[model samples]
Target: MEMRKEKAALSSQQGLNHSPFHTQEHMRRVPPKEPQVTCRSNTYPKGFYCSWHLQHPTYIPTDFEVYVQHNQRPLEVTRDEVHKNRCHVKFPELFSSFPYRVNVTAVNSLGRASIVFLLVVHYHLHRGLFGPTVKPDPPEKVVAKPVANNARRLEVTWNSPSTWPDVETFPLKYFLRYRPLIRDQWQHVELSDSISHTITDAYAGKEYIIQLAAKDMEIGTWSDWSVAVHSTPWMEEPKPITSTTESDIIPETTPGPPSAAPRVGEPTAACSTLLWSTHLLLACVLLSIM
Candidate 1:
């Protein structure tokens, strides 16, 4: 089992190498978009972090930089453990202030596009232009499954993002969106401080795509939507029909009446009439003999 898992991982990693970025068609282009830096504190008063990403693969050795800006001192960025395009910066300071400037740029072999977010920023004004809180990371480990025996119900569940250190102290609310593959519109709902929800009105037997976003309860903007999870509502299985042979059949029978016996469920008068007819027949026989 472990060997099979290793082989599967290896196959996926190798597939990454087969991308067009690895080919020699074109290389070394200027960064397409400016970096839009988002720095926020999921755990307030303790510290805050900033993270940004390269829009697309560069095909060459690439690195990211996040600066303190005011002091021109470069803030060290650590690459995320899972996502290579993104990097992280941890700062002991905090903020909520007048909008600060952010510059984002992307250059790479996969150069389709890039963009910069020129919105609010700063280290220590005690509140963003919008509010005191900031958008938390999106929900994690999202799962969507069909409810058993319910063709129109879908159950979904997820966990708080790991970036939020104190879930018990500072709760998070969620927004869920889902749509079936056949439709373009999405159905959305707000789940207050809950990690699970049931979509009771899902189309029966239809496959659905679901995603979730999170924010600090009562404050802050919503995070980006989480990765999508797909599911299908339940459908009952058809029952098999069994065949019966002659041996399994019992033919119905009717016995001949003895002396005109009354049928079952008949009135008691039927039995009396049968007896009177017998007596009249006997009398007629005696007269003939005389």
Candidate 2:
């Protein structure tokens, strides 16, 4: 047993001296061959289920090893084998916003290939059909009420979203939505051209929350819900004016005091002239008779 162990150790030392590390293969340096890599999509989201298909070019051996390098360091990723010209690679985390290169190498039964492939991994923003891209800006102000002549009707008035330098022409279409405050249901009213609307079927004295959204026609996107405004119709009953109590009635038929006669000496100038005229007339008559 001792001789057998000694013989095995001697053979191992001889093989080690003839190996590539001890010969010119160790001293000689060769540039790592750049493998041929291709990408399917230019942009991809992080943490989602996505695959990157990669394969080396035509070579002696079709086997290859895959690796992901972040900042020039090998990432902790398990490479999957492929039967065809494709291999699926998954990313656990998104490192940067820009593109990151993926390195792929080929290996065969003889030995691992020195060739490597570099692929760009593009990162995309996390977004859905209706994601959180909606801006949190407040909504415009709106006022609504019933007309005087109509009892079961309402008229709504609105002003554009208050902004500095005053928006000359509002480019967005307004969406007016309202429903009973107490109920869970709602009603939507879409105004294509007009900002104000006249709605008649609303309940009397009921409060409602009117919502508004500004549609960006340029980008064809709708902004988030603006700040909500509350509205309630007037409920006070109309009262008529009437004099029902005695205190409210006006007084009539008041009595007047008696008046005294004029003084006897006040008219003497006019009365004496009239008496002298009458005496002259009587003397003329007596003379005529004599």
Candidate 3:
């Protein structure tokens, strides 16, 4: 048993040597500042997560190791993959009168700093200075699209954060903000008991960026904004005129013979009488000559 314990300690020391937070060389070395720890559970009662950070910069490569204890028994601390200084610890047993004790150690070539935080679970004389409060995760599955045939309307829809356990019992309110690419200002709306909203005043044909944030209805602060979605309001399309329609608008004219000349009026009766008299006088002169 002593040999096994020795091997386990050796393995843990080796793991620390390979941690990404540590570096061998020190340039502009400074001692680490006091660490601040925050722990919360989006799924309260089931579990909690603890994260820590430094108030001031150390100006050199630093290493951090976190240890957590509940009722004098050690709990497993999982370091965050993306954030080296942050870690998570899950509750093995729920609803305890004892407090969780967290110790954070910061080390560098120059010096080291350490701070311990005590967080109480299941209350009594522990005022919750360092807490396991209920903070929700960001809203998810956010989508934005243009309303069909509505040039000025853009519709946005989202689902509750999946990490939240019971949405119906512990409702969440949402905050939505959207803005067109051409403008720096954003339009915001607060919604409860609804997951969708239609922007009736959006600028037509303008592309917009939309995002959502969430908080529990009765407790905790708002979560971070979800991934942004891009969409543009609908625009009316012009209809094309076909050849048949154009022909109907302008009718064809058929060719026909040229119009006949206007008719001449008959001679007056006075003119006819004058013509007869002249003819009789001409006949008399002809008889006399004979």
Order of quality (lDDT): 3, 1, 2
Write one digit per residue (lDDT tens) for candidate 1, span 19-61.
Answer: 6775443455443545546666565434445566555445455
lDDT tens digits by residue: candidate 3, 36-121: 88878776545667787888888878888788998999999888799776777776765467788989988887778888988765
The digit string of per-residue lDDT tens for model 2 on 1-290 reads 99999999999999998887777554443323445554331112222111333233333334556665545756565333543534444444544533334556655444444434444443334321111221212345666665665544567776654431113332446677777688778778766646688767667777777677655222224545666667665555679877588887778967778666668677666887999999999999999999
Stronger candidate by TM-score (1 vs 3): 3
Query: How do these models rank on TM-score, best leading?
Result: 3, 1, 2
Could you estimate the TM-score for every candidate?
Answer: 0.53, 0.35, 0.62
Best by TM-score: 3
What's the lDDT for all of these models? 0.70, 0.52, 0.80
lDDT of 3: 0.80
Cα displacement (angstroms), candidate 1, residue 139, comes to 1.2
